[model samples]
Target: MWEAPEAPPRLTVSALTAQIRRQLEGEFREVIVEGELSNFVAHTSGHWYFTLKDAQSQIRCACWKGTNYRIRFRPRNGQQVVCRGKVTVYAPKGEYQLTVEAMAPVGVGEQQLAFEQLKAKLAAEGLLAPERKRPLPLVPRRIGIVTSPTGAAIQDILNVLRRRNDGVSVLLYPAQVEGAEAAASVAAGIRWFSENPDPDFPVDVLIVGRGGGSAEALWAFNTEEVARAIADSTIPVISAVGHEIDFTIADFVADLRAPTPSAAAEMVTARRADLLAEVGSMASALTKVMHIRLLRERQALETLARHPVFDDTQARLRDALQTCDELTLAVQSAVQNRLRFAGWRLERAGNRLRHYPWRPYLQLHEQRVSELTAKLIAGVQAQAAVAQHRLAQALTRLNTLSPLRVLARGYALVQHPDGRLIRTTEDAVPGQDIVIRLSDGRLLGRVAQVLPEPEAKPDPPPHS
Candidate 1:
């Protein structure tokens, strides 16, 4: 009776869609699908909508920006990619799609392709230029390390330093060397050393790296941010990631590349003992050179001393002494002859003096002196009289031509107070003080007139 009354079961579109969505989402939770990408459209909402198909069929695919951003290379329309995701049914569109969580180029792995792509981009930009790389410090006073504190990298670096007895102090900047945040953490560590360097404990070179790991695990260093951080580092960066064969973008941009963490430590630290040994070697070489130089110089001087010139010195001395004796004898003989001739002249003079008469000569000289004295006295009086006559004539002539003499004859000379002679009335300004000079003295007065002299006319030419 109740079974007879049961009506046909009804299913709403929403309920049917919900059931399908749950089944698809649960069954296809994780899958790997290799297909060719087509109809690739990126929405403004940062969600990629595309269709992935092979020979048999095609299906819709979607990759959000958050997932796509982790992809190393941009996916193209015809690219063959192996995508990993879940199959989910969209309720609104009533469609089934692959929600891509990870994608990789089919031929080359994602990490390798991404590394190559980034390397080419950075190389083109000159960030990987050989000239941009810096030389390591000869003796780094302080060394900064950016790696996991508990990793083998730090232990390796420390062991090398301790073994070498390098005096460089260590500054550890702990950072995650792997995982999702590895790139940001590594970049932040590099930036901290570059931006917040302590002057008192200055760091010379920075070692940024980690121990060996798989390519997937070491992908952080291959990131652009890590490479840029290395490139922009102020201190010299030694990239010591993985092993000698494993290289990353950071290795290209770093100032130097170390094969391993131990090598990186060696690069930034130099043992004092090694430096001292080198210096000692140089000093020994210098001492040897100087000794050789002095020996050569002494030999040269000895050779000069034993020459023939020095050997004949005693003979030269004897010859010089003999010549000096002969010169002395000749000088003595000359002096004796000079003395005899002088003695003969003195004898002749003495004989002549004795023969001359004294009293008669004195009387004659006295008489001559008296006559000459009288004549001299008369000549002196005549010369004096002539000089006096000449003086009187000179004074008379001078007085006749003198302006002062004219002034004495009742004429006055006009002059300015400044001692300028007033040749015309124009020489003095009206109401200005003027000077009048008498024969004996000057006088000052005020000017009352300044009349200019009339220009003189040329005289008529004389009749021919």
Candidate 2:
């Protein structure tokens, strides 16, 4: 024999799958596939399975949970996206597909596209309606802030608040301001204020914002989730993301929007602050109003005072004063004439008295006084005797029923310290203080004994 029998080389399914996997992997190590997404299925395991198809051709693509979950913008069905990932053949299926390391929408700037898409979606749901907006509190009692704990946003807000002497309570809910998790974190902060509201530090308004940054840095605010959170907040929300020139989807859904984080603080307190700052102007305005009102009221009163009715009443009062003056003069003349006539009569009477009435009248008056005095003595004696008889009779009747009379007849009244009369021995308690009232005075004594009444001897067994 010249050579050993040659063995046939037949490849197994595993070997063929392996060869295809290596060959496809080498050919498309790093790939950028641009196509419209279709049949997208986000598996429960967080893996995204979809078809990248165009008008002419189509290819299968898979975004692993590990790689694709990092993408910020959500990939939708029929959305034109550029997927960048390594092309690898799935060993089991022997099909080649993009791994989808990253993805972005086509035609528009990536950030702008995401922003517009979310804006439209939210607008359709009425989250962007003016009716959904809430007015800033006239005087916010508490203001909740959602931003990075150490970021410049919080510092700016605090500085502004300090400058204005913002009396409203501030509660800072620290969350990442710029990152993949920033949107969810911001949403969580809104929900925290909306749900776990503290009665002591109750959040009346929310300021969700960050300092100025690039569009990508503030992209978290454009997220649909964060927008929905702002829309659904029970408390009024103020969106203050980026600078004045930059706008986000959050600004559309929030109850209010500020150009910057510091501006948000000023806005929350602006109603009260503006009024306080222009206190002089307001005072002037009020003074003007009061002056106008006073002028109007004064004119009305002056018009009333000038009425002919009042003038007629005043004329009548003047007439009364004139009549009173005339009467006064007439009374004075009449009094003077009466005094002169009385003086003449008194002079005539005095002359008569000097000539008449001497010792006879005095003697007669003295005799009459003596007679009346004797009569008065007799009447006084009779009244005294009648009063004395009635008094004796009243005393006799009172003595019969009086407790003092009973006590004087050798009876004693026992009374408890509380002033209750003790009727029997059972009413007395040993060692308790009591009072015994005799005829003259009350004697305080300690109760020595309380003897119980003896029981009858069973009534002699009461007849069988």
Candidate 3:
């Protein structure tokens, strides 16, 4: 009945879209949607586009790189996920879509899913093999630690190390142990220790850990960056992250795993007293071996001296004497080599124990090493002197058995013209030519006397 209603206000396509966008954004400013993910696409611009659908309907969603970076897990097609976002209309497409701010797995935490995924991936790469692990140094001169400088973990480690008073030089690399940047920081610390070892005191091992904390707080150690850092470290790494029950990827990839930071510190340092005792035992054993060898050499020389064959065979005696000299030289060389090797080992141990800000025990160690060296040298010298003296006496005894000395004592050797010895009166005829060899000179003459000898008288029986 009224005049035709004024034409409804016409809207441009852009205007319509703007109006719809406003209503949708206002109404769905924040929402959480759960569905099966499909048509997933990660754009070159670092944005993610996907469809979330159920049996009945579907909705398009976009996760900008800025927002998706906060998501712990990677989104994949056909996965059931929960997305939180706002709804807005696209002006060009005339469609409403979700601008996803965050996302997670439908039933599990994103962090847990990510952890599992990384674990499986690394396991497949053989990084989790027990054979990949390396043994820690028996004694570490410098220990490189990665953790929060202000945290209880550092304090706990320091307390443990101090309690033992192992005199291990510790180099701390301050890093965030929690939060998003923690993984990067920890990895950087590990890599720094690996690439840039100290010129004077290189890091012997690395300790990567933190104080016990909640799962969220300890997740940095669970990340790929930190795990890879531990795996690739040139230095042996001990992963001491969280309490005994809390495990991280770093724990699996590290060369050794400790349950806590304090425990890690304890594990790294061998007791100085125990190591010194071991060194002492080794030295004592070596000394015993050397003494036994010298005794054997003396026994051999004594046996050779007592043998009657040495008195008759001058060549054999000379050979025996030469052998004795050789043996003596060999024994001397062997002792020196053993002592040198032992000294090398001790010096190496001392270097490891020689921590920075030199501890008092270091001086004591130096003294002990010097004393041991002197003792070894003195013992070797004493043994050598005894051997030389014995050898000289043996040579003197051999000299008394010399034929020249017998010849000098009014004895002479008669020889035939052909240089054969004249032993009996039957062989030495009156006309045979003979030579008389004396200590001073030789005489050539005809054999003029080969007389027969008279019978000698027999001895009487002993009186009862």
Leading candidate by TM-score: 3
The window of 10 residues in a row where model 2 has the poorest summed lDDT is 304-313
Worst 10 residues of 1 by lDDT: 349-358
How much lDDT does each candidate structure score? 0.74, 0.73, 0.82
The TM-scores of all predictions, comma-separated, are: 0.45, 0.43, 0.53
**On residues 1-464, what C-alpha lDDT tens digit does candidate 2 reach at each position?**
34658865669988988888888898888988888776667899999988887667878888888987688987766477888988888877777777878888885434556667888888898889999889987656668999999989899999988777544468889998888899899999999988898865467789999998755578899898898888889999999998897788889899988999988988886776564445436435544553454355435433433344411344543444344345434434543454355445434434433333323543453455345434433433443344345434534444454566667889998899888999988788899999988888889999888888887775556576
TM-score of model number 1: 0.45
Error of 3 at 235 (Å): 6.4
Model 2 error, position 308 (Å): 12
- Kindly report which residue stretches of model 2 are placed more than 4 angstroms away from their true locations once superposed: 1-106, 274-286, 289-464
Write candidate 1's Cα lDDT for 212-241 as tens digits: 875646779999999999988899899999
Those runs of model 1 whose alpha carbons end farther than 4 Å from true positions after fitting are 1-106, 270-278, 309-464
Candidate ordering by TM-score (highest first): 3, 1, 2
Give lDDT: candidate 1, residue 398. 43
lDDT of 3 by residue, 1-464 (tens): 44667866778989888988888899999999998776677899999998887767889999998988899988765578988989988788999999999888875434556778999999999999999999887767788999999999999999988877646688999999999899999999999998897777799889999998656578899889898888889999999999897788898889989998988888886545467678779878878887888798788878877676523456665676677678767866876787678678867766655656555776677787778777877877787677667766876787787777888998988998787887778778888889998978899999777787877979999999
Model 3: how far residue 417 lies from native, Å: 5.1
Tell me, what's the RMSD of every candidate?
Answer: 40.3, 37.9, 16.6
